[model samples]
Target: MPLLCHNGRFADTLDPVLAGDNPSFKWGEGLFETMRMAAGEIPLMHLHWARLQQGLTRLGMNDAALQRSVLENILRELALRNECAAAGRLRLHLYREGAGLGFVAEAAPLAAADHGWNERGWSIEVFADARIAPDAYSSLKRANYLPYLLAARRAADTGVDECFLLNAQGNVCDAARGNVFVVRGGIVQTPPLSEGAIDGVLRRHLMSLLAAAGRPVQELGLTMEDLLEAEELFITNAVKGIRWVARFRQRTYAHAVCKELYGLLGQPFNNALVAP
Candidate 1:
């Protein structure tokens, strides 16, 4: 059986530990971070930890017991116990434990990491049934993920690999599971957080990587027409790094730029078990 870490303790199951009255279970009052583990190390842990702290502060959740070193050790131990220490996807969930605003941290192994980039680009479309609001909560990876869940279900039903969600202003916000990026005329552009895009860890890292390489990304609002007109399109997340898009409606994109960018990301992880 797979083991999970709850409040610094290892357990075979969570049922006996988490109560039904827990705020996270009852009303989705919590935050979560999904991280990639490579060579038994979490490379982007600093970014993930920063985001988690920001989320906790934003939600007014008491973070007195949240320590980066402690959480990191727990995740590393959980990965070892799960037999995915070399490469894996891990998740850290923080939720209200009681009425006094205390929180509990749970670490679970998501899966063994896929080290290879996708050869066939992802196929995606816009989810028009609902528009995500451009609010403070939109940027955080909160436990309540109804919008993305519904969009993902629609994509599955329609035979698409992913679905893009738009902001209330009808601008492209982000994808169902990742942040969207477009390449046009050798310029890379992505929706700004002001446009309601999720503050993705990989997105931030990629932007820094690009800027350091003298190819800074432009943060701006993107429309459906912008995607259709782009030379290439891609989505990014912490685990996947970057996934090129082959088809968005009738438009097909080239993967050349995606390949180069993926290599750029992989350079740092060359010595590690998993690369971008």
Candidate 2:
């Protein structure tokens, strides 16, 4: 049986998530991280964990035991699986544990592209639906993914690859699964965190790379009209890495910038090492 972290130790029997009702499941009372576990080793785990801790603190449910136990179990599992002997993405989850409620870290998922079935190129729309970020939990990757999942489905049904959700303030913040970057005139721009975009791990990595390389990856407020003038558009996420947005509201362009960003991810996931 797969192991689970509970309170501060490992349980070998049925997962608590399967055994009881978790508020995270019903009320979305927990935060989670979608990790990139390669060969069982998650290179950027420290960064992922930092974000998790912050989210827990924000929710007033910080548990040092849960954190330590999760990390220990992940390392142990990696050793058992010999994941470091190979390379692939792994996702881990954590939920608050208690009576009538417990969070579960499900089995790892395959590392694959979820957006833009980019055969030759990818196409997406500037979906005009507005979803203002909930300030109380905007920063957490909590269990309430229904809104995002639903928006993505709407886009897919429309024959579009993905959706760019502008915040209620009417600025490009992020997509259903990733952050948005608008490139034009040799400048690469993404919405600032103030725009209410989730601080994605890959997004942070690319920002450091772009800044260090002198690539001019600016974070600023942007408008829909800006999409028309954008020379190139792309979305960045941990799983998809970087996908070029070929079409934005009848505007089309060559994805030169996406190719550049994709090159950053093709190399490795390093926190301190930033390169052009």
Best by lDDT: 1
lDDT of 1 by residue, 1-276 (tens): 777777777777544767778888889888888887776788788899889888888998876657788778888888888877767778778887653343343334433233566777899988989888988888999888888989999999999999999999899999998999999998999999999999999999999999998999999999889999999999998876788899999898998888888888873232233333
Whole-model alpha-carbon lDDT for candidate 1: 0.82
For model 2, how does the per-residue alpha-carbon lDDT over 29-71 read when each residue is reduced to its tens digit? 7777765544455655667777877877777774564545556
Against the true structure, what is every candidate's RMSD? 2.8, 5.3
Clashes of 2: 4
C-alpha lDDT of all candidate models, in order: 0.82, 0.65
Candidate 2: lDDT over CA atoms? 0.65
Worst 10 residues of 1 by lDDT: 267-276
Single out the weakest 10-residue window by summed lDDT for candidate 2.
267-276
